[model samples]
Target: MISLVSLLVAAALVCLQSGYQAYAQIEGKNDLRDNLQPNIIPMPKKRALRPFINIAGPPPESARLIPGTLLELSCEVIGFPAPTAQWLKNGEPLTEFDDVNEIMNIHPTSLARLTSKMIVSSAANGDVYTCVATSGVKQQMASTTVVTVAGNDEESLFGLEALFRKPSKPIITEYYNEVFQEIGTSILLPCKHFSTSPSQVYWFDGDEKPVFGNPRMRILPTGDLLIPSLHWDDMGNYSCTVKNAYGKDTVETFLYPNKKQFFLVTVN
Candidate 1:
């Protein structure tokens, strides 16, 4: 029979060789990667591996933007089991179906690339926004440097400057002069305004009467009009008028009910 000591020595040598092989394989892959350019996305590891995030794009740095304009904050997450992304404004989770927000997301593939986009209508100064990504139980966060409002004051600058000074005439930009929608579907007639003071937005019905007593219609804080769940009688010309202390503006859009599908036919 073989000696007991000799058998133990042989087993030790086998274990050492196996360990070295694993170490060499890992090191080799690292060396190869170091020699190549950065990848658009990280390689997907096995499902059993620990989850991690590689932020594709960092949040926007401190910047100046005009009021009544849209602000988009986005982030991309990559990991196993597929990570999910969401946004927080001033630490509050943003709502998707709210009046001022429309969210867009691109789901992850193999290695998992999840992208989150938030549209902030009429961004103001001193706004704090953050992006967060989560995979299972773990989470990663990205934040911005403060977005100060444009103007010259500590409390009343950037966002609410109109509250401190005399009001100026507002400028209005209409998205669509006319729109046709299928009955029972909601629509937003964008009426963007830039003004020295906060302006009042008034909407008139097809009969030229103020739009009130109808629970479905309302004006957004940004001066845009929202009419949820349209009906057949809702068809007619709608007027969007903005007024401040100094001046006023009007943008008219026609809403017609579409009972059938309309398509353009090309004849060659």
Candidate 2:
């Protein structure tokens, strides 16, 4: 009976060992398959970007005018992504007023675009105006024609007519006299000294009052004063005075309205 029991125990032990081996083999096969296979995790993708933007247009030129005169401004621009348009006066945004008018425009295309216009009266003279444009994440800016207002109307008949027609103030050439000649004669005053600063050249009759301060007179490219169609009464004592933050200096010359006159120059 004891021998029978021993044989049964050995057989049972062998069966248990075989079952353990089979289970271990199955687990190893699963681990190997997991390492050899690619991971099933999902990854994110990248996106594209938009293009750059640009703008182009004509800006306003310098402006001069008589006080109380009306002013009008027009501006246009081109750009990409369509731009926002606005106007500024003296670096400040412009608003509608009794003496002012403004217009804005925009267009659609691969390249966006804009246009603006403004109008103001003479009281608005001597003031500066600017136009600006903006698009999606982009912007552009431009200045309008600088408008200069005219001075008082009280002036000599000879100079007054020039002021009304296109009167220009005489620029101070130096603290010295300027020789002027008859209407048809050519006169040259050395303006090299006056180019350093913008000064006022006052033409006065015997009373020592100013004859011209308006824009009727134009500054010639050569730095000489050009009075287009001279008259017998145009001659007088002309004084060029420079005024800056530092101080002031005056130069005077005797001129004959119809004859050519040249004066020696001295600057202080």
Query: Which stretches in model 1 have alpha-carbon errors above 4 Å?
Result: 1-167, 266-268
Q: How many clashing pairs per prediction, in order?
A: 3, 26
Worst 10 residues of 2 by lDDT: 98-107
Tens digits of lDDT, candidate 2, 132-171: 6665556666665555534443432334355345522322
Which candidate leads the pack in TM-score?
1
lDDT of 2: 0.43
My TM-score estimates for the predictions, one after another, are: 0.39, 0.31
Give the 10-residue window scoring lowest on summed lDDT in candidate 1: 102-111
